[model samples]
Target: MNRHRLRLVTFDAFGTLFRMREHPALTYQRIAQAHGLKVVSEPDRLKASFQDAYRKQGASNPVFGRLSQGSRPWWKSVVRNTLIGSGCPKADVDGALDPVFAELFDLYAQAAPYEVYPEVVPVLETLRTTVCEDKVPNGMGKGTKFWMGVVSNSDDRTEAILQSLGLAKYFDFVLTAYHFGSEKPGRGIFDEARLLARNCKAEECLHLGDDLERDYNGPKLIGWNSVLIRRNNDHPVPAGVATASSLKAAFADD
Candidate 1:
C-alpha cells in the first residue's frame, strides 16, 4: 500500500506511543504501603487482581462510565476493587482508596510512570514535516498534508500524558474513549477519528495500534487502512496481517 496517499494517520495511545515504566501492581503496592495500608498479596497476585479489576470495571461500566457514573468514580471503583482483590483488608482499603486514587490519578497524568518509545518522536517528525515528490509512488507529496492524532481507550489522562512526554505537539487531536463515548473494537470510535480529520475519507486514513482486534480489525472493518503493531518479539506476526515491529518500520517502505 502507498502510505503517501493517506491523509490522516492515527495511533492507539497506551501500548502504541507510550507505556508504564514499571509493573503497575508494584506501584500500587508501594502506594498502598506508603498510605499505611497493609497489602499482603504477592506481586503476581496483585498484578492478576489489578487486571481482573480493570476488566470488570470496563465490562460493567463501559467507556469509563461516560453514560452513568463518570470517569473518576469508575476509576475509583477499579482502584478500590484492585486493592480488595490484592488481599488488602477491606476496611483498610476503604479508608485509603480516595487518597491513593488521587495520587495515582495525578501520577499517571504526568510522565512519572510512563516512557515514550524511542522511535516515536523521529517517526512522527518525518511524517509531519518531510515533503516528497508527487510523482513518487510511496512518497508523501509536498502539497499533500497528513494529520496525526491519537485514539485511546483511556480517560482524560491520555492527552496530559502525551503532553508530559512532549508528544502532544505532533498530533492534531487526541480522542479518549471516555470523552468520545465510544471505545475501540467498535466502529464508532474509529469513525469519530475519521470525522475529526476534517473532510478526510475512510480510504484516506490509516490507524496503527498494538491490539489485533481493536486497532487492526476494527479500523479495517470500517474501510480504513490499518496496521497491527507487534512490538513484542515473543509472538510471530499473524498470517496476512499488516504487521510492524515499530512505528519507523511501519513506514519503512515509504
Candidate 2:
C-alpha cells in the first residue's frame, strides 16, 4: 500500500494521455481540387505546412491550440497567412482561398486519436480498483470514491474523444483549459482542481502530467505535491514534491 495520503490523481490529456496521427494529407487532394488550388497537390508541402502551424501554435494560444488539436489548417489558409504577413494583398489572400474554415474542419476530421503510451490502462488499473459487480473503477481503495480529473488544453470535442476511446468512465471530473479559457503554467486550473479535490493540504493530493511548465510549475507554485512524468521536468526539484520513475511503480505490487 502506498499509504501516501493521495486521495485524488489528475492527468494531462493529448501528449500525456493520447497520441495524435496525421492522416489529413489523404484528403488534401480532394479539398484542393474543390478549391481550385493546384499547389496543395504536393502532399509533402501540405504535410509540412500542417505540422508547422500545428506545433508552432500549440499551447502558445491556449484555446486555439486545443481546437486545432485534431484539425490541420488548409494549405491555402497557411499560404494566405504566410503571404499576408509577407505583405500579400487582401484580394490575393482572399482569392487565394475560399471556404477556409470548412477546409480546416474537413482536415480535422481525417486524423485519428489513439493511446499515447500503451501502458496507460494497465497502469491506471494498477493504481485504481474496480468496485461492485459492474466493475466501476473507484480509485485505489474500496468503497471510498476517489477523485479523478483531467486538466488539459483541448478543443470542446475532447470529452467526446475521451468517451469514444472508452476512457470516460475512469474519471470523476474532467477540466480542459479550452473550456476555462486559459492554459497551464497559469495556475487557475490547478488552483480550481485543488479546491475540487476538497483537500486543503497540497501534501494530500498529487498531480501528474507531461508538461513541466504548466503541469509541474503551476501546481507546485500553490504547494501541491506534483510529479514530472518525463516530458515536464525542466526545473530543479521543488521542495516537498516527489518523483516517480513511472506510474507502474505507483502500484507495482497490486
Candidate 3:
C-alpha cells in the first residue's frame, strides 16, 4: 500500500491496540470474592455467563444502553445477571453487587486491566511520522499529513482507557459507537471516521483491526483500505484480504 495515498488510519480499540491483561471473568471473580459473594469456582463458567449476559444486554439495550438506559445501569445489569448466572445467590449478589460493580468499573476504566501490544507504539510512531517525498516539493516535508484515530464498538470509557495506557496522544480522535450512534460492520461509523479526518475520501483512508468481518470486510465494502491483524493465527486468511500477524507486519511495506 502507498503510504502517501492514505491520509487517515483508524484502528479498532480492543483486540487491536490493547487487550485485557487477564480474562475478565477472573477479574469479576476476584472482585466478587472481595465483596464476600462466592461466585462459581470455575472461571470459565463465569466467563461464559458474562458473555451471555453481555449479549443479552446488548441486544435489549444497544450502545451500552445509551437510548433506553445509561451505560452505568446497563453495565450494572450485565454484572448482576452475570453473577446470578454464575451461581451467586441473588440475595448475596444484591447486597454486594454495587461495590463489586464499582470496583470492576473502575478497574476497566483505567489501564490496570489492559496490556498494550508491544508493537503498537512503534508502529503508531512510524505511521504518525511518515514523510512523503512527493510532498517535499509542496513545502510540506516536516511530516506526512497523516492522521490516526480509533473507531471502536465501545463506550466513552474507551478514551479514558486509551489515555491511561498512554496511547491517546498517538490519536487525533477517538470515536466510539456509544457516541457516534453506529458500530462497525456498518457504513455509518466508518463514514464518521472519515468526517473526523477532515472529510478525507474513502479510498484515501485505511483501517486496521482484528475481526475479519468488522475490520477487514466492513471497510473494504465501503471503498476504504483495510488490513486484518491476526496476532495469534486464530483463523484462516480469506482470498484477496490483506492479512498480518501484527501491526508491525501490517505496515511492514510502508
TM-scores of all models?
A: 0.93, 0.64, 0.94
Question: Between which residue pairs do clashes occur in model 2?
Answer: 71-108, 185-214, 212-232
Model 2 lDDT per residue over 55-161, tens place = 55553543654444432342344435433333335574467455644665544433343544666777666445633122222333445545677888665666776
For residues 1-254, what per-residue lDDT tens digits would candidate 1 score against the true structure? 56676778999998899888988878888888899999888888999999999999899989888988998898889889888998888998998888998988788789989988999999998888743335323343467667789998888778888999999999999998988988898998887887787657788889999998999998999899999888895676668899999998999987
Clashes of each: 0, 3, 0
* Full-model lDDT for every candidate: 0.85, 0.58, 0.87
* Candidate 2 segments whose C-alpha is farther than 4 A from its true place: 1-4, 23-62, 65-111, 130-143, 231-246, 249-254
Worst 10 residues of 1 by lDDT: 131-140
Q: What is the TM-score of candidate 1? A: 0.93
lDDT of 2 at 92: 44
Lowest-sum lDDT 10-residue window in model 2: 130-139
lDDT value, residue 80 of candidate 2: 51
Candidate 3 C-alpha error for residue 51, in Å: 0.9
Which parts of model 3 are misplaced by more than 4 Å? 132-144
**Residue-by-residue lDDT tens digits, candidate 3, 106-192:** 889999999999999998888877755454332334456677899999987999999999999999999998998767889999998
RMSD of each: 2.9, 6.8, 2.3
